[model samples]
Target: MGRDTSSAMVEHLDFFQSFDDVKVYYDNGQNIVKQALDRSVGKVLSKVVVRRRKTSMAGYRLEQVADYLSTIELALVKYEAKEDGETYNKFFGGIGSFKRNWLKQARCKRI
Candidate 1:
């Protein structure tokens, strides 16, 4: 049978969710910081790759990239300050809690 990555990914989401909640502790309430870090790191990596290729920034100076990343960081900070905690009120109960409540009646061990 052909591998069904989508279904497999869905099945594995619980593992990722619990790890996120317990180990990383970011996906639920602190995604904005993650987003900013991703943006800035992406730009820095692109700059490195382009330099390695011996190509110009194509009218995008290094300073411009820095400025853009800084802008994204500032925007996320503003959003974090303005956002209400209600956004994650339900999520705080967490994936483990949901699984316990919903899976208590399941008869199959794998399912």
Candidate 2:
């Protein structure tokens, strides 16, 4: 039998109360991260836009958002790469490849 029994065996994993489903967790995580980033960008822009009044700062603000998102994505990739190594291997060993798995791994690492 070639069936993967490992995943069929349930693993006890706790998550934030608001996220019942993994997809929901991922979506909420992305939204929360973006919102926080946007707030930070807004604060910086409020100060910078005063002096750069003539330039179109809308495009520049968007570029900053994109850059921050890319940075977060890179950190997640690092977590996924770590999953293949020694850290938290026991917790994530048989979970397989899901984009949100990195979130779980990162959380576990922090605790």
Candidate 3:
């Protein structure tokens, strides 16, 4: 089954609650994202702005950084589960190095 979009959106918004304002950019699923944003409640709704942009046309460096962070997070998950380590290894050398170099630093900047 597909993931629950509404719940996912709420969780993501919750993660950024400390921020005074948030601007979200996505390449697809604009309708789903907008509907989720509309349904959201609390102070976070006031802080968030969702914008749709084609990835190819997105010249923002933040967009690329977000994508890289997301990929690293997914790779970490897969690595821990023993499902996939190729990506983690290719980019980070090994699990020890991944945790020491990337994971620690990434956690500090997590949104």
* Predicted candidate 2 versus true structure: per-residue lDDT over 46-104, tens digit per residue: 33432222345464675655555554466557555664454434443332542456545
**Candidate 3 vs. true structure, TM-score:** 0.44
Tens digits of lDDT, candidate 3, 1-111 = 013644565579667766765555545457766555544532335434543344553567778788878877987887799876576588787878888888788888966
Off by over 4 Å in 3: 1-58
Query: Which pairs of residues collide in model 2?
Result: none
lDDT of 1 by residue, 9-83 (tens): 346766644542221112223666655544443343332432222334554465555554554444444445654
| lDDT, model 2 | 0.41
**Clashes by residue pair, model 1:** none
| Candidate 2 residue-wise lDDT at 61 | 70
Model 2 C-alpha RMSD to native:
17.8
Per-prediction TM-score = 0.22, 0.24, 0.44
- Which runs of model 1 end up more than 4 angstroms from their true locations? 1-60, 83-111
Best by TM-score: 3
C-alpha displacement of 88 in model 2, angstroms? 16
Question: Residue 24 of candidate 3: its Cα lDDT?
Answer: 53
What ranking emerges by lDDT with the best candidate at the front? 3, 2, 1
Please, what is the whole-model Cα lDDT of each candidate in the order they appear? 0.39, 0.41, 0.65
